[model samples]
Target chain A: DAGITQSPRHKVTETGTPVTLRCHQTENHRYMYWYRQDPGHGLRLIHYSYGVKDTDKGEVSDGYSVSRSKTEDFLLTLESATSSQTSVYFCAISELNTEAFFGQGTRLTVV
Target chain B: QQQVKQSPQSLIVQKGGIPIINCAYENTAFDYFPWYQQFPGKGPALLIAIRPDVSEKKEGRFTISFNKSAKQFSLHIMDSQPGDSATYFCAATHAGKSTFGDGTTLTVKP
Candidate 1:
């Protein structure tokens, strides 16, 4: 298993509240990604970072933001939570174009 | 638009049966194809992967058949066991980015 850890394995928050999920890696991979998994949608990329402070938007980046301040930590923030944002989130890390290693996953529910 | 498409939203097979999952991609630039297996409550893990230069590759009882010209790939599990039941995802990668399929839930009944 990869040395990836996601904080707050489960979370429940009210609508319009702020929430942030953390992904920490000990592998020192160059790339880290945030993804959400839903019943029919599979895994949808939310955001990814290539290096410290370098980030890009994924297919479903709306209403979510991410920051990578160091090589080992990547953060995903939802400025205002919504019911539609309820999903299982996964964090993955890889070395440039190689196979990605995923964390256990974070389940967040918005009430 | 989805860059990669997968078929058979779910599958059921008896023990010792062979199960196949198919995936298709429209992007010609995709050079790497990988399959992931996820058990209930766990994140996905890499099961098998293939590069377009080869038509087929096998690891253990798992095989990946690739048809670059047809823009398609498939995973075949030989003599699958009840423990093989899980969700499978197909992915395509290019330039450090990956697109995943909707996923296939496989059930190998005893």
Candidate 2:
């Protein structure tokens, strides 16, 4: 509904392998966020970008990295996948500080 | 430290009944509060939101009651339908980043 799309809606990778999730938006929003949802933990922010080339870590940023080179694209990469990292990742976009709209989501599994 | 805390990890209610979810925050700096609803296999979507400046906000059957002094907020769904069965999350935002509660699953049975 927010013109947000996350590539590879579902993915499975073996432990120690590299995995990357991509979030694309058509809204040209200034704020983009990456959040992971797990049972009993709710949705935890992994990383977020305020603008192109401006990104910062979140509560659970360990072992994960993100980059936003353009306003419409934000990328999250798992340098080396781990079983504990398996979870549903959501991408959200917002203009300024208004409420954010989330993408369908990307379900990633590490075995 | 857990910034936001939500209660009643799960709930059940009959159709047409009102369901309330409560959340509390430790950070008084949080000014923006929002409630999100998520169905199975889908990402969470904004159901309703309230700013600290207001005591209550209503959007259709959904309402957000904010208590700044108590550092707490709650969401109430009026005449909840079976379709309203989903997981709900309460979030607090100080800036652009949001801190979320664990989530509450509501089951509305007909």
Fnat of each prediction?
Answer: 0.67, 0.74
Model 2 regions lying over 4 Å from their true place: none
Angstrom error at residue B34, model 2: 0.7
Per-candidate TM-score, chain A: 0.99, 0.98
lDDT of 1: 0.96
Query: Can you tell me the CAPRI class of model 2?
Result: high
Residue-wise C-alpha lDDT for candidate 1, range B1-110, written one tens digit per residue: 99999988999999999999999999999988999999989999999999999999999999999999999999999999999999999999987789999999999999
What Cα-based lDDT does every candidate model obtain? 0.96, 0.94
Report model 2's chain A TM-score: 0.98
* Candidate 1, DockQ score (0 to 1): 0.82
Model 2, B36-70: lDDT tens per residue?
99999988889999999999999999999999999
